[model samples]
Target: MTLPYGRDDDSAAYHYINAALRGRDAEAWRLLAADSHVEQTDRVLRAMLDRIAVARTHRTAERATARARAAAGEITQAEYQRDAAEDATKASKTAHFETLLREHHRQIAQAARRLRGDDVRDELTDLVLALGAAVDAHRSAVLAAGYEPTPADEALWARLGELDVPDTDEGRTSVEDLVRRHAERQDDLGRVLAGIILDVAGAATSVPRSALLTEWKKTVAPTLAPEQKTEFAAKGKGSLATERLRKTMGHLERKGLVKRSPDGQRLDLLDRAGLADVADGRE
Candidate 1:
């Protein structure tokens, strides 16, 4: 079977070339360096470009000649039309290949630059007084962006608390600490959610959705209290506790205390310590 060549083949070749360079393959690296004589790779590129230019000029002339011959009755119109159609097909294929090459050229340039890591540096001075202007700018940007932490984002941030690595304020209130604390500051229900999620954690990263709902009914159903059940009887059929659980989990997710598993049927507990802090009470 004849294997077709297309974008997949081109992409594989591009990746292979860049990976070879980044992996320090000596021969692949030579493309960037040249001997004192002639730049070998540059010459090869220029030669290919020159050939393409010549071919383009030839193609224009060839089409014009075919049209002229057909008009002068030197060749039959049907024959000329068939040849023209074939030429058009070839031209389209060539055009697509050229476009792919141009894209490869751009991405390869970027990949090469990143591979070199041209100007990395260590700390220039003792930044004991502050994190320096650049670090300060980044922190300010994070603040300015008005980031609203979602459950996934919060989960990641909460997990970072394990590091307890503070960047600002000199070893106090690591960003992760602030995130865990945010859980406490929200509402009474959030602490309640934290306790429930903590109870669900085990060898598994998460528990099924049904597991959480069942647990919710046991923990917070108004029927548990005589007065509570009577008050909610006319409230409607929707489970207020379940709605609260959804909102509470949403809050927990942002706190990074828990996350929904990719299947979304289970909720994963991310930062156990953060959840512990919440469940112990700050409400």
Candidate 2:
């Protein structure tokens, strides 16, 4: 009998059945059963029935194989029962983990909403702490199961330390304010770091200022709150505008206006040359 193995729809099955019948395949007609309501049966029903039948056949064959193995003394009944129980336990654990992951994502979404001030301040703090604990627990469980946490997860946990939840309401407010301030400071530091990286590493291989600016806007800006963004934007502009300052300093050092150590770590600023370079740049 020809089955609709590759057919995606009833039309395809109909074509296959017609072709089989035209080729005088009696088994195909018997499989189709003239009294069966093919019009009422959807392709999904047929596919599901086929799958169930295949599963049943597999179970029967497996049972027979197991019986033969037991007869040959290749496996014990106790061993087979133990293996079956282990498989069931593994499947249950997998299902439990899937549920936990779904809950985790749901909780994170709730925490994000709370972060946006959709919930009470105290409630938001509790939610954030709960979410963080859940994530840490999940990470520990996965690691225990021999799965390594991604670098991103590790980075997040490190950043969470900077979040430092406080007990008192005043302390919590202070912590939140500190987080905002630190984020701004980090952005300003990043600009300095990017400029320093360009200078010390040489400008030819460095990312363009425009690209760095775009990266800063996309990555560093949103890390701060909305109000903090306005405050930090001015600071960032000032820091970024000092890009030529490093190069000018290097030039002055070469001219004996500044004495830099071999490693460029310490700078002994020579007053005359430093003033001259600054004056020259201004001119």
Candidate 3:
């Protein structure tokens, strides 16, 4: 041990002793702070444990009182039996109603499938292809007949090539008029065919991507196990099948065949007529 420093002396031994004491003092201070934190944490944990114990005791007392009341003449056994029976009846009725609702939904979906028969999509594809061929032929004939294609006619042809059908009422009317006038120049039969084509294309467009996916899920989900369905609903890694769906959607989007929701959580089909045309070899 080193002696304490003299009042006037600045010795090396004094400095060395002071430094050594500082190192030990810092270690002691750290240990004291850690102890203080541990004590505070222990107190908080004890308080929480006490609250839990009190709650458990209160619940136990309540159950004991209820049992005593039932044992006495206050709550009769017949009343208890009646209450239990009523609960059971309500549960049974609720289950039966749920079964009926599921059946109703299944029947409705089946009816919708029958209405949109297996060949409906194929027939729509043929119609789109035929319409596109007629339009292209008419455009060529305009040049052959010594009439330059007007700006409107040129624009309409461009829109057709891009499969950019307008969804609004005014735009639909304009396209109908454009097709009617252009087709009539070829023959009366051409006008009738154009109208039928428009009707088919409109019907096809009415079936949104959500409706298609819902029908697909209804058809396929029953075949999948519970785990498979959960995997399908999950995002990111570990589900190759789910990832494939995402990839296919991405590919369609790149080809301008589909559009995504604002949040990118949903996808919607656009320009079904254009898709049909492409499927039928018009692309």
Model 3 deviation from native, Cα RMSD in Å: 28.2
Question: What is candidate 3's TM-score against the reference?
Answer: 0.21
Q: Comparing candidate 1 with candidate 2, which one achieves the higher lDDT?
A: 1
Q: Using Cα atoms with residue i matched to residue i, what is each candidate's TM-score against the true structure? A: 0.31, 0.18, 0.21
Q: Could you give candidate 1's per-residue lDDT for residues 1-283 as a string of tens digits? A: 2212222354444454446434655555444332321123223323344455568779989999999999999999999999999999988977775554434333333333234432121121123212332333344565579976566655544444444444334555443454444434455677766777767766666777777888887877743433233222213324556665776778788767889877768888788888878888752
Model 1 clash count equals 4
**Total colliding residue pairs, candidate 3:** 0
Tens digits of per-residue lDDT for model 3 on 1-283?
Answer: 2224332343433343235334544443232224223222222223333444455456557656655777896888786566557755765765564344333323332333334452354355446645765777678789789898999879857755466333223553333344545344323322222233334336543333454344444433444454333322322234443343444455445557657677765555575555555444454
Q: How many clashes does the backbone of model 2 have?
A: 0
lDDT of candidates 1 onward, in order: 0.56, 0.47, 0.45
Count of steric clashes across candidates, in order: 4, 0, 0
What is the Cα-based lDDT of residue 186 in candidate 1? 50
Which has the better TM-score: candidate 1, or candidate 3?
1
